[model samples]
Target: MLNRLYFIFLLVPFLFLSCYDSNGDTEKSATLPIYQDTPYLQDYSVKYYFNSSVSPKKVFEDRNGVVQVLGKNGLYRTSAGQFLVDGTLIADNTYRPLKDKSLNGISLFQDQFVYVDDKAVLSNAWAGNLFLPHDLENANLLEPGSNFDFLISDGKELQFLSKDKAPWKGTVEDGNIIQIRYGHEANVFWILGKNSVSTFDASNNQIKTIKINNEATSFDVVGAKLYIGTQNGYFTVDSELNGKPSDLINKLPVPSITWIESIDEEIWFGSDEGAYRMDIDGDFNYYYGKRWLPGNKVVHISSGHEGRVHILTDNGLAQIHFDPMTLADKAAFYEKQVRDRHIRLGFNASLVDLKNGDVNSGRLDDSDNDGLWTSMYLASQVYRYKVTGNEEALKNCYESMEAMERLFTINDVPGFPSRSFERSGYIESLHDSDRWQHTDDPEWDWKSTTSSDEAIGHIFVYSVMAELLENDLRERAITLIDTLMGHIVKNDYYLVDFDGKPTTWGKWNPEYVNARPIMVGDRKINSSNIIAMLQTAYHFTQKEVYKEKAFDLMNNHGYFENLMRPMSEIGKAPEDADDWSKMLSEGWNHSDDEMYFLGYWGLYRYALNDTLKTKFKESIIDHWESERPEKDGAWNLLTAVCETQNFDLDEAAWYLREHPMDMRSWDVKNSHRKDLTFIEPNFRDQTTEEVLPPDERQVQRHNANMFRLDRTGGDGSEEYSAGDIWLLPYWLGRYLGVISEPRLNKE
Candidate 1:
């Protein structure tokens, strides 16, 4: 019966439930010059899977725009679309356009197809064999020479074949061959063996081999220079093919290179762990894990048609496609993502139990902070609606607001909201089953143990809606505010659960708030949150008692002093403190960071007087100063609400732009990077001297440690919803007038 109720809620019509009013728009800025910089293109990837029966070794792009996957057994082709869409790997056929079943290698010579078999080298522009003296049975590397010739290697010797000329053979002095490439500028064929670099002077039939001190792994010849990769790092050789190689350059994200390819004048390196490209700015854009590839063991890197990158791995292929998109465009994409698969009973939820990051194979699972996540998603829609006056955005706000409303009504307790609810009879499968209880209706069960996190989230969204919406929606928002604050005040500042006891983390009374050490984060967070909740309630409801209680807590209970404590002073509790306070102050609580920012919305925005508003702004800026190292987009934008001039707007833009398009929780590792500066472990859990780009680290929400460098033990079974994580800051930036309109094609 409860499952039936869940279906009924899912089938409700959205169009008839809400409408936007044109008269209730909020006042905000038109543009901020500092944030008005031109936008750049964003990179998103589409993965292509291969058959388990095939072992893919290389990937290539043909002139006809088809992707060819060359395997150890045979070759295959996938006719991908022009734009970036997930591709389907075609199996069971080798692309034998030349009808040569015994073809050993292929290349492009003067825009024509060149095919080579064990007995012959052939091309479409030339009839019969160009050179057929040397055997090609064991060939691994193939390339076009500068003078219309072909250079092929079998990891032991190179076969230089030309029309009507005898094939010239060369081998390294002490090592097996690996790569053979012709440098156009040097007019010589560069050969790379296991531990040496050998150059072939075809004009004089002279072969020169330079033995490397380190164990050479890979090499790429760009123009006249040769870049060699060793076990430790990589370095470059001079254009003259000089005596000794330069010292190994180890300043890289990952230095153990496996393969290198210079495609379209850009160099790409593949390592045993991942792949990265060295941009013109001399910095690396690291692509690792399932977020960017099928597997971290990258076999080869090549350029696809029209600047796309085809990365071949042991598992399959990952094609990274770049496109120009503004933050608004990105928000629309995430908007669809939430509406399509992430919306579970109108609460933003993650898609879990996925198979190989396939969205169809996942289900919407429940979380302990359903209310908090939904409130963030709801606030994004609210800000989006106000920014564009979009009817769909307004409807989204209404639907999520209705879901929050049901959290209060799902249980019999007045003014108390459940953490989450689901159909009956699945208690054993649900998380925290001990906290699950049957509602008055036999068909449903609701979760208890709601914390202050959800409470502040509820108040934040409710206050935003009450101030920005009109008529029915406005009244509904204000009613929720009154209900929640009334319950807190009547019960002596606690969220009383159905069992009629204060839930853990929901204690904001003077006794509970003042009990912790002044250095503990909770002392400041709780005092700040309850005061903000009261201020929001008093502002919208025009209730004098809410105002009175707020002042009593601040003036008589030292709540103001607690809330105003500088963030620099927050650290481990004193040795004399109780165990609970010590535990609460262990390191820094990122959840407290999230909660503090959410509360700052009302604490600063709905201040009862200008003097309090000024004080609130100063406190917020102080906190933002402490948080500047993380470069968190949400925290920076939340502080932007205080209208401060220097809130790290540039860093916030970097956060939005540098965030990866893939939201899957893949195992990411950055502790191995040599380019990062490490700092001593401290109370804030900041391990690095500077934070890595969001794309290079583990994908997490606002409540996670931003400076965490690595995450292990993941199988890509979950795709986090960007609704709460990304859209909130993006839309909030739009509403705050920091990020401009789409700026389409501005880059």
Candidate 2:
């Protein structure tokens, strides 16, 4: 129902729904600058709503140049950016006040406005009072063509009527007729009947039917070609491409066609699925439920003054306006856009649907690492709620927390988070090569033997929630953290699976972490993670055993030295080293950077005391200084949370802003751009001359190289969401007091 949009209440805090009016008179101006510097971007849209009971039947601009809308019950008038129903202002602009009116369609002729009521009464609106212009019968449709020349069809006959004379006629079958139009220059009139197209000379003499095949739903004449719209889709052909003027192989991207309108260099197709805009370049901008329309059921379209196009849908009336905006505003707008686009609500549950590009409008499926991504998204909201006291943000935090905590109960293993979870019978396995376990409950299945990444995520989210959420939720956070941390400590610092052995990457025993040389990134990262988890446990539970274990890893086993290694100090492993360690050290460990920074929040924030922070300060600054060159926004904000060094807030904002609005994981090519300066490729395979904007780089996670040259469409691309990537830093900035609120001055 249209009312659902009003109560979808937990939408992004920044997107305020303006009162929608069928009269096309919402006060939102599309001219607000998006970016303060770059004002050339013409990317802005506004949504309008009508009274729940008022659905638009037709819409047009009046002769006086004001927008007017015809609703199921009455006529709506637009004046001075407000819609008035029967001359009375309604409290909310979303619903236009309905009043009794006799007219439902309008036209202009010889300076006199013609209005047609449902009863087939034709009145001259400009004659000071309602008066019939001519005796009419079954005039259901108005063919408003030239000022003096037009035809009205009541099924069997087409009346060639004039403002001052009796109507003349031409015969046609009732239901078989589609539409008719007259060409001024050619001095001929054409009839687009369902089965065939027939033409006549200006004198009304039949001039034979054009050779044709399948029925044409609608058609437009431009020069020598006919643009045909059909149930099968759109086709274009020369007036007589062959002996039989068959439809060409061409088709629009939509499923079925209803109406076609051509505007300047663009062609618009209104279909059963939605509206499509194809530019001269053949690129398409599809409008569907989430982006522009409240629903995809488009009824009719009317091109209005300027670049605006009015779309009348079964739900309400809306207009699409194009205007210039700045890049900054564009960046801010996308946050709201991505939230609505990627968030999926189902069965009282919500999750960040990461692979939106893959699913499009379909339902979202769980990724192999749903918990990991949800942890990051959850952390961002935790920060937002703490900073802004926004109830919506807190609600989102609880929803994701509920999902994250499910990972523990999903399997028999006490605290092992599955690689992913899904309804039973959907798939046989999580990975083709890895074993997937079926839980005791027959309704669900979850992947087993989860790696340390899940463990780290559990600790991070739980630690943050424990501090930020109130009473009951805070107590719940403590339970999750203690259970996961207790599981690790109980299994000799490893994530034990259902089969009673440590998961491959979950091994954090001193033997494994200290087994590799300092040059291997894993040695440093694993050591850092275990210590952080131990410390976070101590902070939440105030357990003496957690602090003792952290000290044991730090002092006896040299985990402190391992954690303190500067990021730049690592290099290729020694030639004589083990095979696995050498292979790991062959290149910069970008994933280690992700794991290290993600762990940093708990490592430093919940440190046992001030002295440890003072001792760890240099290591933190050095690591950030080395990472500053890459300009990773997520890492920078995590580093800023340590509060021991200066952060590049502008650069962080740039990374978030420069992140592309088009989150589709399409293959992007920036290596060939003339604007790029060539530079030597790095070990991580980044080939850009310099950091091209975030939009041009390979679709990435916080773990991937930010400046990597090419983005592989869906292949070699990680399943990621703009929400987690954006939310991570945006909330971090908020927590750091850098970004207070979005600068969208006018909602």
Candidate 3:
């Protein structure tokens, strides 16, 4: 009988999973392997800066795959560590140094250097060969020929030199030449002018010129195809010199192309705004501003060492390195980042006021949402502990857990958690100093006016710990949950401060919650959060009062109807409503999205009954469907808890993979991108038809609008910690068994 009873208990979980699958049409499972790395190239940047007065004109890779930049003054070479080195001349047989002065042009033929001076095209290939000596006048550009030896241009005319054949000369038929490039596959020399393109067949010395719709700016040749760049956009020309209409290929983020090149079989466009690479899918990987480049004005581009892209701008040179990385590898990187500079007195902190994205030049500082942010980090550590069983993750949870405990004990209020606490005597430095209060301990001060956000965050992490932790940690988590909820229930659903008054945004009483129209997001969010809090409080403490209070609010106050309302019906308040309600409903509050998703953990996992659990799943799925367009990894991963078959697992991985490695809040601008489609302004603040990739926009947390395009006047002063923004969803996905373990050794 005992064995039969144990067998029956073992079948319960399988029965639950099977029954859960019946509710959805598709199976809710991960498509990727359970223990393999999804391989992709993770890009990071290395920058080389010269003196401020230097004007960089062109860039190319040397025979050894090192980068070399040519400027107005002379050529500069990149050292072993991407540092600037003075250019040196190659010596001849007599050990006489070749002159490096007035070197106007540079190129490569068969991996050997071929440079041009004022009088000749020179090379060190065969004991210093100087072809076309004194024949070329004022040569400024040089390119290797396909059928001949080399093609040299002087901004006005072109000269082709060969070792065994007579030199061929040509001039643009329609306009003065700007650039001349040799199409190796077609054995043709393509010429770009101010307003037209001309092709030269060196075999027959034939020239064909065609006028373009826009003023031509730059051009590149890849085999039989010639890409022509103009002032507004670009078009393609075939080997037969057939030009496509400009409008057919004009769609680009930045159309003012200044330089174009084919590097590693991929088309890279350099513009006045920034540089971008077109992938095989025709989508763009934009590299803009200080995050990826030293300057916006790109002058030239080349393929660098080990598949890196070297871009020379007006200010300096940037080499973007693409390294092979998996999602697990990225997580470890973020973990080190948080531990190195983002931890302050056991709380997750932001490094603000850095000079030029330097990690050492900044100081960790507190935020208004201290508890909320720390809770997210602590929850990440909790999930990390559960997934990998790493002792370090548990230690992280313990340390941040101590910080959360102190938030309650730092102040005189019994259960009120302070917004943040800092070393005393810095009151003047804190934002809104009026909210700061001194503790009895002279060494510390605590922030007041704590709101519902802190309350929900505290309960969310506490419940997670109470469910997943062991021994003393579990008991402490349950106790804290009861203490916080006890205070709220005693104060009539309000977070009362030391001044004996309810804090603004801390009210969840029926009078406060039910006053707003149902369309208001606050009404829905507040109702959803408080119910989840009470349910969590009851589940851990086994308190009858917590259970009774939750049912009372849900049954008597109609919170179920409010939270279960479809997202489509949510909009601006009725015209006749109160000013506060109208103000609250003016837009969709993204902060509310964070709070609601956080609250969903308890709302669904700790539901009072299976019937309520099913309804909670439906409500969660409804909200997740509305958030589908943003492709938010955290929201999608959180929605997976509802047992839905499709939660955009692929998009979640994309978000994780595409998130920028640099967490600094660099000034990024995407409004000038021609590829984005603008939309009519709405309450949700979605500016485009589709959201840009995470690396293309400004670095922001989950609460900010994903569609926000530009951050002007920024100086890269602040660097956000990835603990709350990135690690939370990543470790959560790991804990949920959707993301795989690291195939590469974690070491």
Candidate 4:
């Protein structure tokens, strides 16, 4: 049964393909878009290192841009000192010669290194900790500005040390002492207490003190503002320290920040929660877990020569860098990723299946609708092979074709394709209503009661293979189409089964279609589908009966009028045509849009006559015009199959490239976002004021509403595969010459 079915499937395309003239008016000429090169967004390259022998304290760059890491045992330098690449590491500290055995802190001063142990020890070329300050206890080196100074404090007094100068002492008058702020060449010095900040000038004159409720731990001067990290969180105030401070801890991932490094408007914070980077816009991206960094407990963060940000954690050190790529580059990389990572195996064919992005492999018999999705992926490879001549693409296309064709012969009906087939005894019915039947071969079982969705998919893939396939494959595709169309016609345009009755949704006869009111989307879609099917059959077989039946439906049964009607008149059915059809169509059906467009390949491409072709183009344009606001990559790119001003080439590429790399189906909540623009609710709740980025929106099939912010799978949790969804539009765009291969970008 499978062998005969596969043979007819493989031979269907050769019989009728290339029937339309390449140079004829059927293929119209329009100015296609020219897309610019876009760089691919690269994934975060994170590498971890942990050695119990050494506890890293700080990772920073010296004045010369060379990366230096200071650990508990000693200090070390990287081989690529100028830029911290992923694996840039040198030997452990080989020279640990210091006057004092303990080295707690460090600062660079004009070709000299200052170390803080019991006192300040300055080390230079050919020397190690040669200069030590006397009477300095708990001393610390500070890199506030151009000058490398040392600061030491007791409970009553604070002293500052500069290059080749004695210590300058200052006294503070305030509530019980907390910490002192003395950095960033300013005229005023500040003393932080529990209740207020005490300010003193260069001559020890007390300035007006600012009162605060929270206790501060550290402070830094960034631009014209002063950021104070307190027990509650970080707060920002004017540089003068007398103005009100605004709390910014809510933006950070943590509650309390121990240290902060503010540079180039990018602030890095070491907080109780983790390591975080708060950008100029106040948005936060973090690195904490061992999956991202060496340790989750962040102690310090500092930036160096390159874009690398050095991190100091409780256990070890880590460095990270970012390099941006254009959108075009990302599209290619993602396309390849989908092919390599998501395709289902064991069939010896590249069939993309929904995955959880883990070790779980979704079997072919896992779902009844796998054939539909697999066909979409197969069609994409057909196009990819035609465009790039990739042999792997062609081989995958052939293998998937074999799998799709078996759906026909595996069933008892002449041309009815089952939703899915599995080896008997290995499968159980998912529900009571499931239509599983044992095949003639006792070893196999197949799903019955297939609907129009699977039928449209079969026709669509077979049609595409005819145009794109060559050699024996072309012939097989044509023969398969003839068989399926023949069966539909022979059974009175209904998918009859073992029970000898039409399946619930496989009806297209005048009796079933006309029974529905003119207002029903089913009426219009059925009219549209049958006409396209008849036209395809007539074109492939050169049969007069098929054309006559098409004309009878069009002229006598109002199928032509049903299809030619404007899409705007969809929801406004006349009062007289009020019934089940009208009730079912009170709201517009978006799935019909999918049905119309999928059938459109046959309707417009293999249209039997020029008159029908003109109406087909007009209908497609009207539908696209209404849907343009969605900014959907799938619909927009699919419409590009017809080259016109309506096609958005740039936006299409942007949508794909900007799609998030995280493909998991995590529950996303966008209702709390303060940045959304809202519009009044429309049909199916699709009328959102603003469209969220692709990643932030609900995970959905191409047929689902793109603007919806809250969406879960039918079963509440299913991270669907990106295989078919991405491949369809990508390969379609390539076939239409809308997007070209991107240039390889280098960092």
lDDT of 3: 0.80
Ranking by lDDT: 3, 1, 2, 4
Residue-level lDDT of model 3, residues 1-747, one tens digit each, is 222233235434433332122121221255432324465788866666665467777777766564557666666765323211111221112212434446688877776666788877776666775556636567878887853377777888888777766778878865478888876667777788776788877777788988766777888876666788876778887757775633536679899899988887789999999999887688888999988888899998887666678888887878777766677767777887788889888899999988766777899998889899999999998887776666677889889989999999999999998999999999999878999999999999999999888889999999989988775888999989999999999999999999999999899998999998888888889899998999999999999999999899999999888888888888999999999999988888888999999999999999999989999999899999888888898998888877676888888888999999888888998988998899999888999999899998898888888989999766678889999999998888877777766544432
Best by TM-score: 1
RMSD per model, one decimal: 5.7, 13.5, 8.8, 10.1
Q: Global lDDT of each model?
A: 0.80, 0.61, 0.80, 0.61
Quote the positional error of residue 583 for candidate 1 in Å: 1.3
Which segments of candidate 3 are over 4 A away from where they belong?
A: 1-36, 79-100, 124-134, 146-148, 211-213, 242-248, 744-747
Poorly placed runs, candidate 1 (over 4 Å)? 1-34, 37-39, 53-55, 79-104, 110-115, 123-133, 164-166, 263-266, 745-747
Q: Predict model 1's lDDT versus the native.
A: 0.80
What are the per-residue Cα lDDT tens digits for candidate 1 across 1-747? 222223224323321222212222444654443465354767766666665656666777667555667676656665342222344567535334444445566666654456556666665455633544457577756778866677787777778877645678767787588777777777788887777777887777788877777777888877667888877789888756785677889888788888788866667888878888887677788888878877777877877664578888877788776655556556666676789889888889999998866777899989999999999999988887887788888888878888899999999889998999999999998889999989879899999989999999999999888877765888998999999999999999999998999999889988988889899999999999999999999999999999999999999999889888999999999999999999999889999999999999999999989999999898999999999999999999999888777888889989998888778888999898887889888999999988888998998999999999889876677889998999899878877878766543444
Model 4 ranges off by over 4 Å? 1-30, 40-341, 344-357, 360-365, 429-433, 514-520, 564-590, 711-719, 744-747
Q: What is the lDDT of residue 420 in candidate 1?
A: 93
